[model samples]
Target: MIIYKEIEISIHNSIYVATKGLNYYLDKEVRVIIGNQQESDYVDVIKYIIDYIVENKPIVSKNQNIGYYSWLLQFRLEDINYYDLYEVKTDGTEFIKGCDTAISIIREQSEICSYYKLHPQFPSFNQMVVISKGVYEGKDIEAIRYESPEHMSGWWLITDDYDDDIKSLMTVHFHHVAFNRPDILKYLALPFGYRFLIDNNVIHVSKDDI
Candidate 1:
């Protein structure tokens, strides 16, 4: 008698499903499941599995064509600015911690903002913690502002308070501006936020995982 086995693995919070056949054939799929109900939620998962089989599970080429897939992912993630964090750091110790914390908070907020379509009138703010060795030479850091299509604006600004022998700087950026529609600004901001998270290493996944 011949038997088949199916296996599942979770990597970086994403899931992969694989199958091994009695005849030595193998199959696998990578996918993201949004909700708990229905097998239709597994459509992308299944398609990926089929493609994997057809392509013989080749490693993704660095130059492989992503095209619209890239855009689609960007569209879902939102707008984010990494320069804002870099501009505020005064030293290495403070820079590392502050950057990490900021990235984490921004990732959380981005998801909330994306889900709720956070209103521009109600802006969000958070402090970045820093631990550094260099003297924090207090200097005014200029703001980099971004305007989204939804008529929303984001402003990253440094604080007036400075710690001598500067290790880190505390800065705040607000992502909110009243857009014409309720969720327009939030949607526009997701890609920016996603990019920021990626650049800062706040969230990570293999190219094959996505």
Candidate 2:
């Protein structure tokens, strides 16, 4: 009955076997039903997204907007074969969402044109969204939708759209998270979308509750 930041539950026989530590349970043979709200996913992806989360890794969207706003990127991360919405600035040559630990930048093209011609931040250029599945080297990777679409779609339009084709980098700062994130998700979805459950206090959850 020790207090844990997160709990890993295997729902095979309603046994609900409780386990501690994110990494320990992730590699185990369990379905992984994390119930710590925000702490669960955090602990789960720490090894893949935080400790090893590097920016500006060259990712090519095999095709444009394949399905539900995700691309088939050539991301070179093996852990990403699962779910995780990561928003990387297409231009690795510059700072994305103000992140600094960028290793190598792909600088994927310059045309990130989008349909933001109405908002105050209209005439924007470039785009970044939570990627689902993508191929690394020669495979398929999926971008996770941590929250509902309505909750996360807003960040898809906050790109630098001032520069022309020659210089698509918008001079105006269009970063969504300038003050959040120990994880790369802060750059992809709205603050409320990803951080909603981080501070939640759900003591227990039942099938009817879901």
lDDT tens digits, residue span 72-168, model 1: 1101111121111111122212222112222333344456555546421223222121212211332232223333333233433223443443436
Determine which window of 10 residues in candidate 2 has minimal summed lDDT: 103-112
In lDDT terms, how accurate is model 1? Answer: 0.27
- lDDT by residue (1-210, candidate 2, tens digit) is 323334332222432222334333233111222333333332333223322222322223211211112211112222332222223444322322211122111011111111211111111123333321111111222122232333233332211221234343222222222212212222232222221121122221111221
Show model 1 residue runs off by greater than 4 Å: 1-59, 62-107, 114-145, 148-155, 161-210
The local lDDT score (0 to 100) that residue 103 gets in candidate 2 is 15
lDDT of each: 0.27, 0.24
Count of backbone clashes, every candidate in sequence: 23, 12
Model 1: residue 47 alpha-carbon error in angstroms? 10
Among the numbered candidates, top lDDT falls to 1
Residue 47 C-alpha lDDT in model 2:
24
